[model samples]
Target: LEWAGDEFPWVLEHHSNLEPETQTWHSKLVTENWDSPIIFTSMVQFLEVLFGGGSRGARRMHNIANSVLIFDEIQSLPVNCVHLFCNAIQFFVDHARSTTLLCTATQPLLDNLKFPDKGQLTLPDDRELVGNMTEVFEQFKRVEIKNLVRPKGWSEQKLIELMITQLKEKGNCLVIVNTKKWAKKLYDRCINSVDADSLFHLSTSLCPVHRKEVFNTVRQRLDDELPVLCISTQLIEAGVDVDFNSVIRFLAGLDSIAQAAGRCNRNGNLDMAQVYVVNPQDEAIDMLPDIKEGREKALRIFSEKDETELLDPEVMSLYFSYYFYERANLMSYPLTEKQAGRKDSLLSLLSDNHLNIGIEKNAIKLQQSFKTAGKAFKAIDSPTQAVIVPYGDKGKEIIAGLCADFEPAKAFKLLKEAQKYSVNVFPNVWRKLIDAEAVKPVQKGEGIYFLEERFYSENFGLSTEVVSKMDTKIS
Candidate 1:
């Protein structure tokens, strides 16, 4: 029940019209069987259960014990909670008897930091596991990073003007900006200036299924060599695999820049494509260390010479070297047992052998977690109803196969297994839901989606605070 767009059965059940039996069974399977086995949820879901509030959340709370948990985009965890989050994770893996997997293309430098030696779990060396990611990145080099440095300022107009040329020539391009507002602004400009069908708006505004639909459509166009233009926030920076002939990135961190580069000519078909690093007016992205540190690191390295030379990996390595060095510091913190907070941290919640000692107490704790989950779910975009888009013959067959040994928690897994047939909300849609807020328009703007502040508050589950403290550094 910690449901979101990417979790399909939940989405199907939440957004699609479904039979009563299917819906009842889905609820029972998720709520009653807390220890059913594998659970597929997002980083936000897991974090909310641990630190925030809901009812279905508590139902699945105790189940964290004695299972393997995987967190996608672990780096996206809020910065302030990194220590607490990682420590809790360490407790779960070592003491609570659960194993965890941090899945992402760009691994956050979590395991490298210091924590209690007693509770530490072994994580693979991401650098080695990825084995010279830079080398692999070179082979996949479909892009060349271009610097668009102009003291006059880079306007949305200028960005779209250049992108229009790329779209007409190559028929596909992706533009990534630091925020949703900028993405919307650019997306509107493109649509108004060019063929609307050829231009696509992608953001966290749409649900996951909606985003997935858009992504699939875009992918098909790329495959068919049809004209397509997409404007999006940095959410699509990692994991998403579609590539374009060119990518124009608003100036941000080096890691973000590298992530933007990863999206271009990723199939290695074409020679190097172009990735323009341009500075956009009216926003400072380098507000956080992750944002500021990399760009600043790149700037410091290039201060004695030309900025354009910094795009080469040999030169860019300095950016990451300095960037990770600072990131490592952010990861460093001392943890005492008292700071562990949860009583479960002291007593293993998973062990059946210890069950006799605090059975009632644990029940109460689980109930609390569920209550919190319910509260939190309401704040974020929770599924109000399930959606049932008719599946083609292949999709029906795939769904039939999953129904054979179906577990409700495996809804997303089954949907993913059936990717050949169906489409759920892609990840970016949820990102938009989580990021964009409904606010009244302060200025007259075309193609702009105005949102109310209450909607923004609700979209973030009314939990996370809006952060505007971006780094003011130039270059």
Candidate 2:
């Protein structure tokens, strides 16, 4: 639901009641009405209404007051805003008659969440919706998790060899890596080794539309029981519905590992699929603290238990408990102390009515920092700038549209279309692209950049070496 606005049209196309005449009405309702009987929205959208400043925000708050709120993939909640999120959930349930459902394969310890004033959150007695969860897990156990990590880690060559071996044995498989760089490298190598049509690459480096196209092709192959191999980053760990006979995952969080395993034998058509967890020697872990920390915790659990226990719900609970304990301080908004001069988190700012009294005198500036607070709340810590890529014919058309004129409505429509051809690059990469003259601003004064070169490929998506080549040419 995070990209609800972008996904609205795609979703509506499949709706049972969808009609050509009523499509515009449905679109308007979805875009304007937050309190629609069924609405899809991002967490940021929800938070803005609850804690946002201005009359507009206050007006939207009523929509959520008596509505049912469901948060899926609960473990993905940002650590820095967990307390704020929990408090909001509690506020809706207690004060507004709203019911809240937090769903996850590996549930976090919500009881451990400590707010500034409310203390720990309390969940209902029958919080575990499924009875005999252990039995359910046993019945649904469709994969055998195999630890392939060595102290020295597997080199790219060795990893490729392992994948080839798996492909020969299993016929179709999915290899999930930790980073886009590694995913691209592996895909480049494997594309050469296998039939180009049977191999697929997926990562955030490719826009959603491109990924969707790749997924469709892969699905068709899988449906026909043809050989297929997909190399992807952690983006495919959750939400993706495709199944593979085998899965190879670069070591990360236990919950993430579980999610990866889900892609294997997802429909239980296979007796028991195989999921291999490996640590790649070529991929650097220093830049990814979450992956590093998660690997440590998951490794500790792996040391104490059998590999098969990786998907056990009890094991998952233990993993999450340890994971949360290690980063307990970060569970609250980090900028609270810096901005408020006290250990007052966003929850404290929203819940404490006394703070609102000083708005006239500026005695407390909590209300003033609402926008800043929202800006600071990041689910993923790394800041990335989106760049428009020339992915295909449609991608080229979008880029052409973006460059042709500056009409607000048409530009807005083109920008939405451009999402399919967009890729998010780190600041360093953005700088490199700028230096290479491979990117130009979307408009005369706009900050958004568009790829100026044919640096994207159908198979690999974006070429990471484009900047270096551009630098060489300039030199």
Please list the residue runs of candidate 2 whose C-alpha ends up more than 4 Å from where it truly belongs after superposition: 1-68, 96-99, 114-121, 336-376, 464-475
- lDDT per residue for candidate 2 within 1-475, as digits (tens), equals 2355552333211101111112233223322323334655455446555654444346567777787778777777666667777777877888999998887777777776433344446787788889899999999999989998899999889999999988889989899988888887897788679876667778877766777888888888898999988899887865778989999999999998998988999999989888999998867888787788889999999998898788898898789777877787776655555666555555545455334334265555444445545444444555466788876677788878767856655664566456556777777887777777787766555555678655665665665554322211100
Candidate 2 residue 309 Cα shift, in angstroms, is 2.2
Q: What's each prediction's clash count? A: 43, 0
Question: What's every prediction's RMSD, in angstroms?
Answer: 12.2, 7.3
Best by TM-score: 2
Using lDDT as the measure, which candidate wins?
Answer: 2
Q: How far is candidate 2 from the true structure (C-alpha RMSD, Å)?
A: 7.3
lDDT of 2 at 123: 83
Count of clashing pairs, candidate 2 = 0
